[model samples]
Target: MKVTSHRDEIRVSRLLGASRYRVEKPFLSEGVIYGFFGATLGLLISFLLSLYFQGPLNRFFDPVKFIESDPFFYLSVAALEIIGGILVGYFSSWLSVRRFIKF
Candidate 1:
């Protein structure tokens, strides 16, 4: 899918005399950027939802309350999310590019 989307750009770059590394770098960087932003957005949404659940809504569900998460726990979870995103993005891009642009 990645290869299909970037096929034209990759071919154009090749035609324009771009070296393999030069052509690949931008795609890899793009993937990393996407992953970073995605993870950050996910974290933000989850945090917001947690806040909402912890508010007056707790009165309705008194028995099943939201646990107050520690700042450190949040930080650790965020770190893990970002790292996982980076790794997934890098590997996926690398695989797609490698398959499409065999050197």
Candidate 2:
């Protein structure tokens, strides 16, 4: 059994291709930078839009009245802001990768 196992191992190693070399640290660093830039841009854009639209939005939905009350309003606004930022960041990252990383 041991002899067969060793033979099988040798055969498998011979059939398989050599291991790939590791990527350099610089490549990984550049990718991180690229992702960070996209996320930052998305967050900024989302924040500005949220700020500009918040007042009008609140006014339009004023009849509900609860949105303007207390911590609920603040919490809702914060959640919206966070969701907007995340969506923007994802899209921006996708665009950056698509545009810059050509096949």
Q: Please give the distance, in angstroms, between residue 97's alpha carbon in candidate 2 and its true position after superposition.
A: 13
lDDT of 2 by residue, 17-56 (tens): 4221111222334444655565566667877998999999
The C-alpha lDDT values of all candidates are: 0.85, 0.53
The clash count of every prediction, one per candidate, is 0, 0
Q: Which numbered prediction scores highest in TM-score against the true structure?
A: 1
Top of the candidates by lDDT: 1
Candidate 2: which pairs clash?
none
Candidate 1, RMSD to the unseen true structure = 3.0
Q: Candidate 2 versus the native: TM-score?
A: 0.42
Off by over 4 Å in 1: 5-17, 56-69
